[model samples]
Target: MRPSPLLLALPALSTAQQQFPFLDQVKGWFAQASNSISSAIPSAPSPPSVPNPVASGAKVIADAKVQPLTKDNYQDVLKPGAATASPGIEEWMIFVTGGNKTCFGRCERAETAWNESTALLSASRSPPNLGLLDCEAEPVLCNAWAVGPPTIFHFLIPQPLADQSTPATTVRSFGLNRTTVTAPEIASIHLEEKYTQKEPYEGIFHPFDGPLAKAGLAIPVGYAIWGFSLIPSWAFMIGVSFISRSMMSRRMQGGAPAGGAQPAAAPAAGS
Candidate 1:
């Protein structure tokens, strides 16, 4: 039997579809529409790329506005109206670091925050001066500041420069944990409390700096020592006596000298 007429038409249908006569026309229309839409809509320029603040150590340092304080220049900068007062600094916040190896990590960590805070402060309307004091470089200055490694000390200008030591007393300290809040935020908070709120000059930082803290520690230690002292004199002697008796009993039971040989009766007469 002959193949069906529909099967015979299949090849022609395939050839017609393959030609795709309307495809180019459809593409042209779509391209024109796309171009019109694209042209009608305003071209949006790309947003500017913002730099990451803490990108690298060098970058952080570059962005930092901290003044390096050495023995020579520290006094001039930190103290206002001194014989060599820095032109603009009203008061100072110093980042003090020491020579201790253990503090190296802390110092390195705190440095980034310190640098960042200084950068932020630099941008502010009433920026306070920030400085860095390397205790290793200036031992005398660090001793005078009474600061250890990785410490941040805020100093207020004393009314009477005669009270040069007043700033030391009023100086508040930020410890290693200051890195948690870090930079502009932490610096701003401190500034707010110090300047805006006008918190009183407590002249002390950690509780350990206070007499009560010392008393607290001392009381416990003293009590322990006193309790030990109150123990009867004979009580200690009892342990010693008991130990002595035990050793003696052990020796007696062994029935032998430690060397497993008794000393010959002291070389009796010319033996």
Candidate 2:
């Protein structure tokens, strides 16, 4: 029987495939046109190696209206102006601290308490400003301000008080005694007047250089006791002593045996 061309080509193809493996693949590729044709060949020009951002470099553009957030601009945003400013009117809570082992922690705790209290107070309005001071560092200032650490002094309606010429009677530090002093005693000294020589609270400060300055001018509280009541006491004591002495002398004379005057016998016997 005679062999067909396709059958006769098998040996040559096998030899060619043996000589070149890639040609065998290429021949199969040519013979079979399937979805894998394009996929089988690759290294595909790498899509022109998309340009690197760094190598190409970025461009600089100028904006006429926009400004960079420089410190000056940032400060401008925070800068206080009349329109946006909180009023100078502020109830200040000065948290004074001393130099002690627990002072730092104690002061911090006091500050927190003050903040909470003031926050509560300001719930209906603006809160008072908080201030911290080291009493050890500014003793003179504290003295002048009549402020003691851990002591509370409320300046109620300061605006109205500032308007009045006289001292506001309401302006006073909380009265303290052994019973009232807070535990872990933060302050012991009490001041009722201001001595801020540097910058006195202006019209708000009340010093004792007034008419009542010389209070010790012998001003009597009531009846001037010139040791007069003592005179009556002395007189009564002297009278009592005189009567007692006289009675004692008479009794002694009478009791004497011969010279001593005895009790008189019945007058009838002498008659």
Candidate 3:
């Protein structure tokens, strides 16, 4: 039977559907399904806003910069108002840090004590900024009177580069690898083990073996061949058969004549 008009129209309709599927109202069904799914779930509340332009700019600047610290460009990060000198910005903080491992423990104890002491301020809704000093990376303020590292000293920067009052002359320090100690000193001091950074078992190799990876991967590799000969694929089998057939002919041609015999010589009288 001949095809019907409706059947002939079906192909054109399918072609048009393939070109613009939305014309077939698939998007309408999809939108309805999406709406149903969305309506079933409770609406999410709006996110709170936090101004982060300065943060984004800082990130970009940090990414672009690789400036090495030198005497010429060293800035006093400890200064309370060291960020800018535009007139009235008060940046304040209690920096808790140690110069070394021994100092680190003391600073941590101090941090715990300070947290305990400031609980009242937190309850009253007034909390101060606190920072951990990166002792090695952060150069100490040159003019501040510090006994040495591994100590807690207080400082405030009221104005930009102004002759601020001298910082406290004396500060308490933690155990600094105690060079000499009496019986009384040994009795008073405390000690404990701290191993934050340590040597790794595998050394520095990563992603693969280090240094000798090329030597390790120098093995012969192929889809249809190995070190000695072609691997047993269809192409290899075909070539081997052809060479074998030619060699077989040569072998047959070089063979001794078939079905031929010679008479034995007469035995000597001694036999």
Candidate 4:
């Protein structure tokens, strides 16, 4: 016997409900799982390249442009105005006036002696300009004490005396000193010319001497001025107050006995 239509429909509906129980909860869990899977995948990192440590060192060497010292081009990197134009009185007396007039013999000997002496003593010598503590004498000596390149000697004579000038005549003389060094160390030396004119009224005037000549003297002047200027107004006021108080105390101590000091007590009111 076949079931009636309503009973058949009722049974089919019940089966569908039973099969679909907690359908919303299942859909929600499926959505959460899909989100978690999407979040679990990580983004890839950028690719890296190998580092080259020698590149920077090579660049520094390339930038240095090491070269040999020569007469034509030795002053390229030396400090400007390092070599004095006119020799000191002692040097002039030893090498110029006392030496023979021949440019090659006594002059060359004097130069050689001076170079050797300077190279040896420079390590222990102090800078003439700044205080002794300010300089690293050894480093300066090591850096500057090199034999100069071979140079031609030229003596300049005034135009008026050129016709009568002789080789023995004292005039301006110029020569070069040579030096050699290993790779990576470059030494440059220059003779900076400073002209001095002696006027009857003005005495000796060095044309090239500039503000650097006064830098040492100006430091102390500026320091003193700065220290005085920085004194606070309160300090001045306090000084004035101390002086005023001292004056007032002295006046009170020296004043006429406060009300004339009561007549010596009147002999003790009739002894």
Candidate 5:
């Protein structure tokens, strides 16, 4: 193989230059070349340093239009405040799942979309009230609402009648995914009502109102019928036989009188 450039340059160095080792001079030359090459490439304009919009100590989602709601205050915020003469003004609210690994990391995108929707709605002249419930923080409340995590719910709640006695209210949910937001209508239950929201119920067995609940109940009933059908005819016969024998034994025992003596064998005829 041919000698390297460094070896070739070694022989060309003058006697005075050789006094300062050729290797040192070569290194210096390389340093200068590198600087030239770097400068020639137009050192990518250093990205202008940007000031962070939020303070280091600030909370996440501070600017979000979506209000963080809890179990205690959620009802008051979503429901009508006063007993109005006419129907209450319609309101819209969103339930979003976040924190504590609720949806296998899928909630991040969903939550982002929800926040964007809130921002969009807030700009409107008559923006509906939007409240967010974090499934991770308020799991019981989410369960009561029959809300599954990693999901976004946009509910259009029609105001209750002034004289409505029941505290319970039903809200209509619109079909919304990560990005879609639309007006809600009662007649569109088939197209948009993927899941029905059941307000929290304290009573036991109150949650068995869904189709899945019906299936759950039906499963047991089916199992019972199947079990009964499997019972052999001989088993029933055996049970009947045992009961009849018991009754007969009881009757025979009852017939034996309390005297326990034959009186005098009827005072034999010939004796």
Candidate 6:
């Protein structure tokens, strides 16, 4: 006699279970393949320096100073009102001294005069109430001092990778490999420039406010796709196996033998 549909399905059901071990192995292989693929792509290289306009500008500033700004003295020049008054100025000075170096230094005497003079100039041009008379003569001297030299203005502009020569390309390629395997050194320098112009918290806190914030948001989405695709196929296989077993057991019980008499009728009625 031909077997019922439920019985016919049993062989298929058993085959599925037997095939599970192979399926698990395949899943492991897939995971390994995915890891290898992720490892294959080389990291982006550090940006090649082809004379950045901004850095050049900074170098010009450094070159003008009598002394280069060190970590210890940076605070002196960076402070507001640093270049003011009779004794010493309490302000920031961007000066260039050597050929390509820019320095920021605190000059108590010169800065005071410079600040007072600029204030006077500002006051003279604007409303009468804006002028500072304490060191009004200093701006004139500073201006005269600034006039004698042929000041070089260096601005750092990003050098595009497409414009560089073969040697530059080779260097950049190696940098990219380092960035991929190690920390992103080149990218970090670019980030420092960005952070210098705008505060770090500004990037993190203001999502709709700036370009950096938008770029930051985009980077994580790419990572998420890679991560989810790596989930093992065995999880699905296990769930399917559980469901099939439950269904088969129910069908088997329903088809069990029913040949026994009905408990002898329980001695009912008149016998």
Q: List residue ranges in candidate 5 displaced over 4 A.
A: 1-64, 82-87, 156-168, 174-271
Segments of candidate 6 deviating more than 4 angstroms: 1-20, 46-55, 61-271
Q: Give a tens-digit lDDT track for model 1, residues 1-271.
A: 9999999999997787679778678879999999999999998999999766464653465345677886466545655455434443355677776555425555655666666666566666666666777866665455444457777666555433465433222456665563464675547745565444444335322222334323444334434544565589999899889999999999897987677776776767977
Clash numbers, per candidate: 0, 0, 0, 7, 0, 39
Per-residue C-alpha lDDT of model 2 across residues 1-271, encoded as one tens digit per residue = 8889999999998998888889968867876776477668875575667754532221111112112222123223222221323544323333454555324434544533333343333333453333344555544434434445654443322222344443322233432232334322322111212311123232322212213222521212111332333357779789899999999999997778886556787678657
Cα misplacement distance, residue 74 of candidate 3 (Å)? 8.5
The candidate 6 region of ten consecutive residues with least summed lDDT is 166-175
| Residue ranges of candidate 4 with Cα displaced over 4 Å | 1-21, 47-78, 81-209, 213-271
Q: How well does model 2 score by local distance difference test?
A: 0.40
| Model 3 deviation from the true structure expressed as Cα RMSD, one decimal place | 26.9
Q: What shift in Å separates residue 156 of candidate 3 from its native position after superposition?
A: 3.0
> TM-score of the candidate numbered 3?
0.23
Model 4: what TM-score?
0.20
Runs in model 1 with CA error above 4 Å?
1-53, 56-64, 82-89, 98-102, 158-169, 178-181, 189-191, 194-271
When 1 and 2 are scored with lDDT, the better candidate is 1
Q: Estimate each model's TM-score.
A: 0.43, 0.27, 0.23, 0.20, 0.43, 0.19
lDDT of each residue in 1-271, candidate 6, tens digit only: 8879998899997898697778778879999999999899888999886965644553343234223333233224333223432222111112212211111222222323322323222333221111111112222221212211111111121222344421110001111121122112322323232224422222232212334224654224323533444567897689889999999998997676577334554776887
Which one wins by lDDT: 4 or 6? 6
Q: Cα lDDT of all candidates, in order?
A: 0.60, 0.40, 0.37, 0.32, 0.53, 0.34
Task: Tell me how far the alpha carbon of residue 197 in candidate 5 is from the true structure, in angstroms, after superposition.
Answer: 16
Cα lDDT over the full model 5: 0.53
Residue 180 local lDDT, model 2: 39
Question: When superposed on Cα atoms, how far off is each prediction in RMSD?
Answer: 16.3, 30.0, 26.9, 21.8, 16.1, 35.7
Tens digit of lDDT per residue, candidate 3, span 1-271? 9989999999998898899967759778888999999999998889999756744453343333212322223234433355542344332223333445325434434433333333322233322222334343433221111223333222223453457542221112233232332222211221111111222122111101223222332111211122223244787779899999999998986674555455568999977
Q: What is the lDDT of residue 220 in candidate 1?
A: 42
